[model samples]
Target: MRFPSLVSGEFVKRINRFVCVVRIKDKEHFAYLRNTGRLSELLKEGTCVYLKEKDKGKYSYELLLAEGEKGILVCLDSQIAPKLYAEGLPAGELVYEPKVVGGKLDLLVGKELIEVKSVNLVRDGIALFPDAPTQRGSRHIDLLIKAYPKYTPKMVFVIQREDAYAFSPNREMDPIFANKLKVFKSLGHRVVAYNCKVSLEEIKLKEEVEVLWR
Candidate 1:
């Protein structure tokens, strides 16, 4: 998706899950961070970041993109994955935030119950999800499992950068979530991942990458 005119800044430090300090034009400012995931690998001191000014909010700007190792740009907005996925499909094909048996899911394309995850953590060309422990993610998988034959549950992982060649669950960070993904795949549910072409101009779904089970 196309982004608004973004201002480039240097990342100072993350103050909390939703806010961070950034340096723009020699001035330090607080920026709102949409992604709740721990992004230690990307948001380092002096790392280049992109932000959009907020008209009226506690923070002056909102963090949208960050530079990864080797100058690769990564979209840090966790909420954009489903929208990117939906844009690729035909109109009215994807439903947003549909209420299910246990809770709400990300999307419903026909009979497919889709849960979209935003991935930005990459190491050695492998994209890993849940940089931190995610109990809610595991619970979502369980709900998908319960949906079962009534609706085909699917997991869609969107890596927010083009550097990753493959996607995998972060077993070291969240073993339960990784195990649940294995069970979901074993039950004949579909699990797919795609990498995106990210830039200051736009971030779009590029190509589907291999989902590594191990």
Candidate 2:
């Protein structure tokens, strides 16, 4: 997905889960953080970030990406994953924010329930999810497990970087979620993981990566 009016800024600090203060054009402004992850490894003081201006919104700008260690750009917007999928994937009746067994999933493509996850953490060519502990992620897996018989349940992990050779659940961060993912596979549910080729011009889903779990 291409960001039309994005501007470069320096990240100041995260005020809360949904908001962050950014220094744009030598002026400090609050921007909406589209990703809710802790992002302890990515977001830092003075880090270069991308922002998009909003004429009428809670914040003047919205946070898009941040420069991590080794000069790698990480896309912080989780919402873009599904948007990219919806734009690139095959023609299917997509129902957004569909309610599943006990929780809401990202989309319902045809007869399948799909949950989209944005991955930011990549180490040694391995992409991992839930940089922090995620009870909500675990709960979604549980709900998908319950919905497996009636509908095809799928979990899609979008690695928002180019360095990933494989994708896996972050067992070190959230063992509960990792265990539930194993149960999800054992129950015959599907897991799709793909890496994106992100650049200043556009961010596009490129190719599927192997899903590794133990």
Candidate 3:
């Protein structure tokens, strides 16, 4: 998806999960961070980042993109996955945040219940998800598992960078979530991962990558 006009900045420090300090043109400013993941790999001191100015808020700018290894632009907005997924479908074929089976799923394309996850951490050409422990993500998998054959369950991992050639669950960070994914796949559910072509102007869904579940 296309982004608003972005300003280049240098990441200074993270004040909290939702706020970070960035230097734009030698002036430090507090920016809103939409992703709660522990982005230790990307958000380092003096790292180059892109931000969108906010009209009226506690923070003047919102963090949108960050430069990863080898100058790859990684999307930091976690909420963009469903929007990117919806963009690939025909009009009226995709539903956003639909309530199903007692819980809300990311998107519903026909009978398919899709749960989209944003991934930013890439190591050794492999993208891993849930940079931190995510009980909420595990719960989403459980909801998909519960839906079962009644509704086709799909777990889509969107790697918001172009460097990753494969995707895998961070088993060391959240084994429960990894195990739940295994169970879901064992039940004949679908698990897919796709890498994106991210730039300062926009981020688009690229080709599907190998899902390395081990």
- On residues 1-214, what C-alpha lDDT tens digit does candidate 3 reach at each position? 8899999999999999999999999999999999999999899999999999999988889999999888999999999998898788775778889898899989988888899999999999999988999999999999998887788999999999999999999999999999999988888899999999998899999999999988
**C-alpha lDDT of all candidate models, in order:** 0.94, 0.86, 0.93
* Cα error of candidate 3 at position 35, Å: 0.3
Report the error of model 3 at residue 170, Å: 0.6
Query: Which regions in candidate 3 have their CA more than 4 angstroms from the true location?
Result: none
Query: 176 in model 1: Cα distance from truth in Å?
Result: 0.5
Candidate 3 at 99: error in angstroms? 1.1
The parts of candidate 2 lying over 4 Å away from their true place are none
| TM-score of every candidate | 0.98, 0.94, 0.98
lDDT tens readout by residue for model 1, 70-181: 8899999999999999887766777899999869989988888889999999999999999999999999999999888889999999999999999999999999999999
For model 3, what is the C-alpha lDDT against the true structure?
A: 0.93
Residue pairs clashing, model 3: none
